[model samples]
Target chain A: MMRLITSGAGALLGGLMMLAGVTGPAAAQGTGSATLDAVKTRGQVLCGMSGSVPGFSLPDSQGVMRGLDADTCRAVTAAALGDAAKVKFVATTTQNRFTALQSGEVDMLSRSTTWTLGREGNLGLMFAWVNYYDGTGFLVKKSSGVKAAKEMDGATICVQPGTSTELAINDYYRLNKMKFTPILIQDQAEIQGAFLSGRCDAYSTDASALATFRFSQGPKADELLLLPDIISKEPLGAVVRKGDDKWFDVVRWTFAAMITAEEKGITQANVESFLTSTDPDIRRLLGIEGDMGKALGLDNKWAFNVIKAVGNLGEMWDRNITPMGVPRGINNLWTKGGLQYAPPLR
Target chain B: MADTHADPRMSSARSSPKRSMSFAWSDPAFRAIVWQVLIVGVVVGVIWYLISNTANNLAARRIATGFGFMDRIAGIPIGESMIPYNPAEHTYGRALLIGVLNTLKVAVIGVVLATLLGTVIGIGRLSKNWLVAKITAFYVETIRDIPLLLQLLFWYTLLQGLPSPKQALRIGDAVFLTNRGLKLPLLVWEWQHTMVLATLAVGLVGVFLWSKHAKQRQDATGVRPATWPIGCGLLIALPAIVGIVLGAPLEIELPVLRGFNFQGGLTISPEYFALLLGLVVYTAGYIAEIVRSGIEAVARGQWEAAGALGLRSGMVLRLIVLPQALRVIIPPMTSQYLNLTKNSSLAVAIGFQDIVSIANTTLNQTGQAIEGIAVIMAVYLTISLSISLFMNWYNAHIALVER
Candidate 1:
């Protein structure tokens, strides 16, 4: 009887594997190729993201998914599917993010994932564009009598494991020859608890995350200070499975469109106005007088739809992250002395 | 009448073979074989399909699949490890081995301590004192009810909440607890320590043989002899004598508060402590219940008969009840040990740098997910099998002997 049951289960799993074999390769091409065609036929973009990062992915006061990462997903869907709401956000964790992407559980990952050459080659994925540039920093209580990360010799630092932040912490300590103990935690909640309970002398993570965490601390916001140390450059970006050049192009250009829209003063509210404007660059970008979207196998009005639906990159950041007190420093457009620059639509 | 009965029986016997042959499909062996073949075929087919699909998918996406990536430099630093590991210098394989060693260190220590602590609590749960029983019960209930992850988090939080190293809670001139970790005296080894250690190992072997000989003599002569004193003499006194002959084996390396934190001492990081404590406390609860049931399963008549035979309560417990109870306890106890080992995987969640966490970082850095997972599963499976084999041997030795 046991053997029979085992065999039966084996058969079912086998059948599933067979089905996966038929669909897997095509799915791996992602939503911009065969997978995208499939998605269009099915009518929804599978978006993977973290559901808990407050200013990046969490729901808003109205119980709607409202965050920077969430908006990025919306922007992609709006561009490709002609509707900002045509997306399914699958909440993922650090442990399952790659597998979720590899297995075609989601078409794209908008999670706060750091892009590295190793992940690009190894995880069978390609990063589309860097959405956020982050760096490791430390948060210490004002009473700790330590003003800088260098002063934290032999201090207990609380850090989340299984992320780039862990490596950054080690590098910072080793480079400075600073002896410190690490209290490694697995989740954000534990890191928060450990730091808040005074278990760790300092908490280390991306500066943006630290800022968001500080703002979320409510009344205790003023009691802690983030040290002016940027240990590692963390370029977080959207990613698709590797080998789908067409899909990669679409996702990359979609981001560029948002940035270009912002640079051209094309707000969501004023996107329609630019559609009729005599500006040739604006006309080309809005697909009012060019075949750019068609070249990527998308509708000509793809960028126009994205701008009208999700607004520009600046608007997305301000809506989702600005309230969290993260300044638009390096994230601002190149015209505003930031690093954001988009290629010409023409 | 005799002729008619014989003729009918002969006819039925002639047809019996034919009938049995027709019913071969219902035979258990035949059914089992058929089921096995069917299942195996389906499973293999499915696996082939999935493999091909994944291959196609990777090929289509241009994602390379192989373990070649493990050779690449990890380029990530591990926080704590038993062996020195430089990510820039070490391959992923080396980093993973370090992780495995760290995991084993925690598992070995945790298993020993948790068993000792759990056995005490298990016994306490059956104590005569209501307060003792209730408190043990409460401890088991509370710890078991909460998720190990949450408990780990709590312990980590509690450890971090300790005062800074400069203002660490110091005990006399030795032990200290700070936000960094708990620091205790380190043992300063001397050349004579090798002699002492050799003597201890020899003494231990001598004590085991002596106890066996003593037990055999008692069985033969029907004269009970005290084994504890003799065993202690061989195990402890012999070691001590050897140490004296060698002029003291070692000296304590007292931890002193240096410029910032204690400089020369063995420190237990808060992460390791949290993971260990959480695993032990959670596993102990299930172990307590197992002990309770095993003790209860020993027939009351056995205890009564032992008492009637002039055996004292302690003697009856040791000579009769315990031996019987062990038969029921060993199997479940082995499972609990396995559970504890697996639960140590949660160490990654709290930053204990166990095999899983290290493997994850290795996978991330090297992009060798398949190889990384294989390493983790193999290490854990080996640990599990070895523990079960050891327990099975122990169980077999104590098995019942029937006339």
Candidate 2:
């Protein structure tokens, strides 16, 4: 009778402790991110993306997700699961992206999400790394004979709601002493359709997205004119839920490895030759002379696997963005006078 | 045999008398009370546990909770508003107020329109003309069967297929129809207009008093005084005379094709238009059937009795049959009204920016999903309850009064 009572008491205490651990104070203060363990067990990354975006994360003819954002997911998957193909893309809208991440529906959001103060501070999520630097662009018909956005006062513009671009356009018009009516639509396809149907005078979104849209139009691309105004800074990047510092580091370092490889003139075709190079930095990055991957709880050749799977950041951009007619102007590396700069892997 | 022959009162008292409650298992009442208490306790405990779990989970995620976000600046630009709104100058609370107003705007107009159309169609369905009856029946059946969202999308698509602003269909240069929406010249309001309108209002009060006096005089004298002459003078001629004497301003501002689109006119956006049209058309179908059933529910003898008393068909319906049918109509009518109001929430799907849409955007922007959802639920509950209370009062007013 005594042993039975003691065992029952022990079981009850263990259950209560488990419950407490699950609901502990800040996720950052928890033991570690359960995301890593979940990812390992699932053997796949549930990557959130705007699946309709042409150059960001659209599905190709073979039903394979393709774009710069898709490549970002693949790079992380290679680091996390040792195989870039072990990823499932989840189509998420602007309104549900944060919720999906918060609810643990998606492990990482590689959608073309703008990095802003409101998103980081207000939402309990963090941007891991900037993969592309873009800006809000306005697309209008060439027949309008309007040269600048200033000249197009009192224009009816089509824009998506709950976007930084919407806020930027409002601010832009207020500052320029002009007026506009924005027909807010949540779906990008609908907004584009509304624009094409002449429900609005112009369509506005990210510059890269507009470029892709125009390119996809083929012969009709000449009929549309992309305005020269960079209304808002849109630094699109990958996002991860907070309270998992270890998982956050894994994502951050994954992008850094690709960028560092780009900075070192390492191409996917030539990475195998550099695996035996005597360069100390390259050796450390590829896990030849150091245990950098051990900190992230990954294989020593995790960076090597990532490069072999998706290549460096430049190669990813060339494969996805170049076809969309988007120039790698400000998205190039620091040596090329662009914005992307990687911290030392060490 | 002698003990069984005891009096009825004595037997009742001996078998089951009123006594103080006991905790014994044999005491049925006490056992029943204990079981009920235990069940209620368990239910309350479960609710408490669930609430605590949610609170703990929210805390663990570090999600901000509360209504303090309402005071922050809302940068969402609304397309159409009945009141003044500037995203830069407005708070989230004010934006949400505008959303509520937009919802009311649609619901009020949609309710009035649906009732009018439904009643007409319901009466038409009972008409002697075969064409009229069949057409109304067809309309009711077809519209009632399709989903409201699809109907809304169809109307929106049809509106989008219209010409652009540059090539809009123009009528007399004062009205323009385009994919953007219909633009109509607005008559600028002035003090003189208000003066004329006030005189009309006073005339209405005069008519009301005159009609009451006329009814009372007829009751006393057994002879009715004519009222239409006075009504015509008060309701119609007086307002016309007031407008002429005051010279109410009649200036009209036409929509001009400015830089890229129409400017300086009352514009009806396709989103709002399609939403209203869909809601009114779909709800009228259900309401028409309710009216049909209500009229059918009235006994056929009421009509024949009035006819036998030498009353015309229209007068028979107005005097006896319709008033009786109203008791049945009103209860179901209230349900249709509530349904119309609730259906307006689907405006989010069509970009109408009703309360649900604005609240959704607000929540998404602020990252306070739980608080935002709570506000939505509370707003809807309050609105639905108020509607129910008012309809219940109206229903009671029309209900049969039993002596």
Candidate 3:
């Protein structure tokens, strides 16, 4: 009996040591691990997103989840798995986003999260690319007659707590030496209530969010106006857990393909025609005559599958966001004098 | 030959040593030890594995893991802080301390208000009047069933739905309520305020000692002391006399409506008011149930017996039932206090700038998740422990002693 107990304890200790040793090296690499390889082999992508942000990741009238970020997920699924619908969307919040990714609950996060250095370094996550260029702005009722943020010296601002927007608003006010009360709310519903019920003289958030909120405010939205003051730059992007270089490449190239396709003037409606065209860039992008996809460990026709599955960037923005009346602005292609530029496929 | 009778066990036991070993292994005591060891071993092993993996992962990602990050200047600006804080100049630790203080402020005030409100409602529920009982029951049932987060949102919305600051509802010459927040009269202190405050404090101590002496005198001499009169004299009259002697140490700083809102007085931010109201109302519901159960736990015969002694219903309740009911009420109420403290963590959700909110910003800014989580958990644990210790002492003192 004593011998058995001793042996059992020894075995348990040995097993633990082995596990520790095996996991240690894998984690140490930080990027490029078996998980990424497994995701590739499975041929399906798992996407994490917020369930309630209109024009970003909300459901459509058909109850199908469709948004600018949701389309990005679809495009990545199409590019990698050859089917846009192969991806699964997992709804998450700001507090749970990183934990879900870290725990392998989701493969990639398409939620509108800012790309911050601390997140990149500490959260064991890798940001692929910026999907939306946003900035902090305030919205208020026109009747209040507050033309700019500076006008309401002691105005109360309603903002979501634990977000970049909260800090940005505070900084903006402090820098301008304007004292204002802050109505901090956690959930989306409360933020709306606080704003609509006139608890706050101003509602501050990302410009895109303000536009979405305005559009969704039903009839009384026309009474509100978004101030033109852009306080801070918020570059929202998709993210994946660190130590997954192969999966990271897949997600990065998927977004880059969308931008490049748009830059080449290729729409989903005309993608098939472009596939047969003789233009070198178009032919290469559509994988008609190139080894680009193979280099990323995917099929040569990855871009073609993506464009066919989900339309190009322009199509996505038009379908999901144009209805909200948010102009393409800096999100447009570089050819259109916007900041969006993709590296050469070659 | 000397121990021939005792040697019988030696001979008999020696016949099945292997059997004895096997039996020992199957014994409940041995089994419990084995199981506990196995469970502990596995859990510890798993934790050790995870820790090592996290360390390796952090190293590989070039992410430093330590509290050293707490010393780094937090560039994020906090909205509301009890203390002066500049994100640009202050360390994350200082910022987190501010958050801790804010959390404590809310918890302490919420606990006191919730207790008072709950005790009243609990008594009301058992009142003879049908209207009072039903209303109390409705309040208890309605608030308890709804989620706290939802109630918080409702209260926040209700506050926001009030008129704008410019059109605030004024209750008197010194009070205003608006979507912005509640404004009340502030005490403008003079140089003599310290003397008045010190006198008030001393008088409070004197009142407490006098009450103890009065109770002892009543027990020995059968004399009924007028506790209320003495309390009023000590608490109010003494303070007033001291204030007069000190030449009226303070003046009221009444808030007056200015350009857009009330000015020159202390203002309770809408966030604070909404959070406090939500917490108090929600916690009071649970406290009411606790209080009701505590009052009910005392035997009906005890109250009847007190009445038999020619005591009125109110006096019987005040003298006999309350002391016994308190023993039952206090232990659970301690847990409620702990719950209030823990629930205050939810203040972060509503942007109340509580400890958790500040810590969250620090964590995000410093990239020190481990340290940030530690600070949050530690603060909560400390608060819980302190409340438990204080309540334990009180419980011991009030506990029934039997021969």
TM-score of the first chain alone, every candidate: 0.90, 0.90, 0.88
lDDT (Cα, 0-100) at B172 in candidate 2: 78
Point out the higher-scoring one by TM-score: 1 or 2: 2
Which residue pairs collide in model 2, if any?
none
- The candidate scoring highest on DockQ is 1
Between candidates 1 and 2, the DockQ winner: 1
| Cα displacement (Å) at residue A63, model 2 | 1.3
Q: Per-residue error at B67 for model 1, in Å? A: 3.5
> lDDT: which candidate is best?
2
- CA error at residue A113 for candidate 3, angstroms: 2.3
lDDT for each residue of candidate 2 in B1-403, tens digit (9 for 90 to 100): 5786576665655665569988898999999999999999999987787667656655655667678889998877888888898888899898888888999899889999999999999988988999999999999999999988788878887899999888999997899999989999998999888887898899899999999999999999988799999999998899889898888878999999876788888999999999999999999999898888888988888888898999998899887877788888988888888899888887766678888778777877887776666677677777778888988898788777789
Residue B36 in candidate 3 has what lDDT?
A: 100
Model 3 misplacement above 4 A: A1-36, B1-43, B60-63, B77-79, B215-234, B245-249, B256-261, B308-315
Give the CAPRI rating of model 1.
Answer: acceptable
Clashes of 1: 11
Question: Which of the predicted structures, 2 or 3, would earn the higher lDDT when compared with the native?
Answer: 2
Q: What is the DockQ for all candidates, taken in turn?
A: 0.36, 0.29, 0.23
Q: Kindly report the docking quality category of candidate 2.
A: acceptable
